[model samples]
Target: MYISLNEILKNSIFKSVTILAGEAGLNRKVKRISVFDCPCNKDILNRNTLINGDLFITCLEQFQDNKDGIYDYINALIMTKSSGLLIVTDDCIDTITKDIIKICDESDFPLILIKEDVPYAVIMDTVNQYIAIENLNAINTLKLDKIMYGSVSNNEKMEILYSINPNIGQYLRTIYVDGGFDSAIEELKTHILYLNSRDDIFVRSNNYYIFILSADDIKYLKHHSDATALKVKEFINNPKVGYSRIYSRKDISKALEEGKRSLETAKTMNMSFQEYNPLSVMQLLVSVKDTQEAHDFYEAYVNAIRDNVSAENLKEILLTMEIYVANSGDYKATGKIMNQHENTIRYRVNKVKGALNMETDNIKFNETIAIAVKLRILMNEIFY
Candidate 1:
């Protein structure tokens, strides 16, 4: 990101200087700075060396007697696409005329005034230092972005990961947020700063703001009874949040997919946040990249139930099973979702198990049934 002229003025070296005009141009980017000496022979208007985005700084000593020349100089700087102008004023050229200020305001061209005592070298150094920092930040952000999207080569990715966090452990977890772009960025930055995890990188991908944090750090934040974590949760104004399971560095692509899947699930379920569950049949279904394979898997799992049960009963059973799996097989919670007594839920579950002819004690049987139920739901979402 480019550093705006407003930020340069906030620097300690330039803080004492006054912004005389062009408040609207404060956001103009300063890419380079140059000292414009009043060249006697060179045509200042036609043959000026200043480029489009350069910040032109000058003493304006030559224009002391020829005030009209100042107007011409300002016009030339504007025509050259100079980012802004900084003029030194004192006994030599103490004041900018009303006409020059008027032209600057009309053009929305930044015109800053510095006291003559403040050496031009100081201003140049400060602006250059800021530009350098901004450039470095931009480079780092691009590297991190490439890593997030799995675009970096293995060697380069490892180097960037090491540079970002030398102690990067065995696992990484991604937190993806959707909505409240600018506010969420600010709040998340505050939260990360408070946690003292400045090494973590935040990047915008598509419509989501993806935050990459160490798995251990996220675990601490989620489980530890820290006020900072609580404050972070309160401050994050996002409408939907998704978190991926811990994964090795080599599985970053899978981790990103899991994060996106979790986000989609959160949106579908109208949830504030959702974490990817490795055991979730929905997650498994989403993991299958080929649509045909996913469809075939769905058919293999659901064919038995569809053949054995009536259409209406299958719908009821599927709903019951979905609630059962969602509630972690808790009969009481599933009953609440079905708006029935615990005994009723048990009866329906037993009936469904009998119809499917599957042993509840068999882990594979239960997993297949869960997948079948989820697949049916997903199909309904598609066809309906």
Candidate 2:
């Protein structure tokens, strides 16, 4: 993204500069800065030299006595759609002619006057640095966006993954936060930068922010994650936090899936945070989709429950199983937590069992229902 010309004027470095003409074009976006020092004779070269949104700055020393040369330069700038022109004036290049400024006004182009005392280096550095930072932010966020949406090429995707951490076979983990206001989200990003020793791959995807940390980055962070949670609590009364299981970047899609499931699991269990277990029975069911049979097994269960019931009952079954699994299959504990009676909780469990024709031991029942509930929760959290 390009920063506007008006923003540059407010950068404090351009305090002495005067807007002699072309004030109407202050909102023009600038992507780069160039010097308009090329000989006025190279009309063809100058026209082709500048890219769109490039702002040119010069003293016009070579064209000091050539009125025609000055006019040619301005015409070239206008033709190339330059952001603006900054002319440094002194005794040698005392003034810009009325004709030049008049032409600029007609085109709604910006004409800035920098005092001779200011060096060209100052203007170039400030504007280029600002543009570079904005471009970097674009690249950083866009790469993650492509991966999240599954649109990136394999080579480009590997470049992004390996860029975060180059060590071989090391597991990368993603820490995700769900749902925060705009201000709170920005605050969370700034807080993370302040808290971490070095920058990690931080990106805002949709309404949530994700920090994909290297294994090394997570070393002291497991401890600091508590501190991180406190920062979250400041914005969210009871934040839902989820971090993915250790996985290679090759399995990032699965990692993202489980990270989302982790938070949904947290919300369902009435917990503040959840670290998804790769060994989770539900994880196995989700993973089964990677192969035809596991795919069939997982969907067979999820579709059976989701399709047979009304939306209201499906909602109830999910909550009931979530509570049932969370309480370790203890009916009384689940009831007490839900503020419902033990018989009521049992009836809900039986209602789900009836949906699936489940006839099994308690351990089997716990694992199966746990998988079903998580798959549903994950289904809700999936985003493009």
Candidate 3:
């Protein structure tokens, strides 16, 4: 139960602070606590509350922002060889308290919320007794939001995590590496850097280091598993040293050859169509071996539906359908988004069915067509 002393003080009043400090006082043998001041001047009076404790209580809250400062404090705690709290106090609830709750839920920090009415004697006694209780802690979904909002942007993290977990990509900011970086292939590890489009590299922390590399680059690193991550981190951290060649010399040539082959494969697989939006369809068709047949089937499907389908009308229908699927077929919400009565949407959808030669009422069929339409738009853009 490693806790930040600052978090405990930030959320409660002077009375609660006294209770917390008193309980901590009972454990004089445990002298690793580090105390920091809240940015607010009002909370400075509580500094004596933590005096003569494990570590001195001053200038600890260096991060100005509540979330940033709290995270900084947490990182400092992890850096230290102690198992105690860091006390920080502010007059009211704010980012510090929010972040503290976040960290408490994310990792084990044993957060004990103190109300002003609770006497210090009762509170400390209760906390000491209740502290032994394990597994009563709650895991809220808010942790994910906290991680995103409190921590650094997810761009670099997403790029690296996507290699191991692709499903998290859409929910995160992506990191992209320039294809032109191939010229410095040998220094790949040493000079390996991933940045958002704006070009800020992610700094690694105890929990994570995020880097975005192309699929081809990720594969290359996987091939040279021995020194991939370490080399990449070194390169990103010290790009000026130009260690790019040192770590990547052994596999640069091989990686370059593989990268070229991958590019060619991707190019060959790209599908295009001009008459209709077929982007999503193009992705599906790329995997299909019989491209000519796929093109013919798509053309036929479009021709049959074109006369009845105006671009705007089809867009509305498709957008509604996508929303429906995204909402798991919430008819009321989907209808509202379509700007048509639910029954009218049902009717238009029925008409779409007659044109597509499928059962409109069938959930599976409608879902499939909706997906296909999305694909068609993407494919058309690619081809055009």
Candidate 4:
């Protein structure tokens, strides 16, 4: 971000400077600083030499009592789109007139009054430093953008990372944010800077903002998972977010794909965010369509339950089966998930077996039942 007049006002050298007018334009970016000394030379205000966003500092010595001359000068600065004007009074000019302040206020142009005791050299030095820093930040942002999404080779990526942070280690998580207003995106960036101690890098790709975090940082976030998730949901302005599993920089491309898939899942389920999981059978099955083959598979295995069980009981039994399979057939774990006793879990398992007419003890039959349960759930979602 470029330095603004508000930032300049915060400097110690400008602490005594009073804003004569144009409070609305304090946020105007100052690209460069120029000393306006030639009061008689109107040609100096030409667009070729004096560009927009230039901050002008002047003493108005030549136009000491010529109010019209001063008015003409201020008008020229406004026409050239100068960011702001700082006038050193008590040197050659006594004070700015109400007419000048009126013009500035109407134009929404920044007008600052500096005491004559404040030397112009100090203002020049401070503003130049700010400009230099801004230029460096812009260059770094460009490099980061190329590294994240451009067609840079692996060797180039390594070199860029080394240049940015020589001690850069593995990036463990990729956070992808999709769909938000530009202002919301800016707010999210500000929040990320606050949370990551301003060490995180951000880049825009298509419709998403991608953030890569180190393993230790990811661990810290997971440790404060509840608070972090709440902060994200609150600050991101309702964007769909996807978080990928741990991965090294070498696998960034794959990690990004995982994040995209997770985002798709979150959008389908109307969730604000989702973490990628490699072992989620429901997530995998949800990708299947209600085709003839899938319907046939579901019927062949789950027909008895679908035909005989009530709708509410069918939902409960399928949910129980899903938890059972997800927990590797650990009935106690499934019971905890279902908020029931182990005996109740056993009763449900027996009901499922009787309905399917299959032996639960047979490993092959159990596997088939798991697959059938997943397909049946997916079909319900598709058709219902």
- Tens-digit per-residue lDDT, 1-384, candidate 2: 666888778766677888878999989999889787765556465457776798988877867667567787787778778899887765444447888889999998999887646778888987776676556556756666666676677677777766643552345666777766334234434534633434345555544656565444445545555566556667654577887866666776666666777765666556777888866664444443345554454567656777767776766667777878878889999999999999999988876776677655556666677765565554543211
The candidate maximizing lDDT is 4
Per-residue lDDT of candidate 3, residues 238-274 (tens digit): 2211011111322322222232232222343441111
Report the Cα RMSD per candidate: 8.2, 8.8, 20.2, 9.6
The Cα error of candidate 2 at residue 342, in Å, is: 25
Model 1 clash pairs? none
Q: Which stretch of 10 consecutive residues in model 3 shows the poorest summed lDDT?
A: 132-141
Query: Model 2, stretches more than 4 Å misplaced?
Result: 45-47, 89-94, 151-159, 164-199, 202-211, 217-219, 222-251, 254-384
Determine which window of 10 residues in candidate 2 has minimal summed lDDT.
Answer: 375-384
Task: State the lDDT of candidate 1 residue by residue for 77-114, as single tens digits.
Answer: 77777789887765555447888889889988998887
Order of models, best TM-score first:
1, 2, 4, 3
Off by over 4 Å in 4: 11-13, 65-68, 89-95, 163-167, 170-246, 252-384
TM-score of each: 0.53, 0.51, 0.28, 0.51
Overall local distance difference test of candidate 4: 0.70
The top-ranked prediction according to TM-score is: 1
> What are the lDDT scores of the predictions, listed in order?
0.67, 0.68, 0.38, 0.70
For residues 1-384, write the lDDT of model 4, one tens digit per residue: 676777767766776787888989999989999898776346676536677899998887767656568777788878878899888765654546888889999999998888747778888987877676556556655666666688989888778756644554455456777765344234434534633443344445445665655544656645443344455565566888887776676665566667767776676666787888889765666566357877787776556766656776877877777788879888999999889998888888878777777754657658777777667655654322
What TM-score, to 2 decimals, does candidate 4 have? 0.51
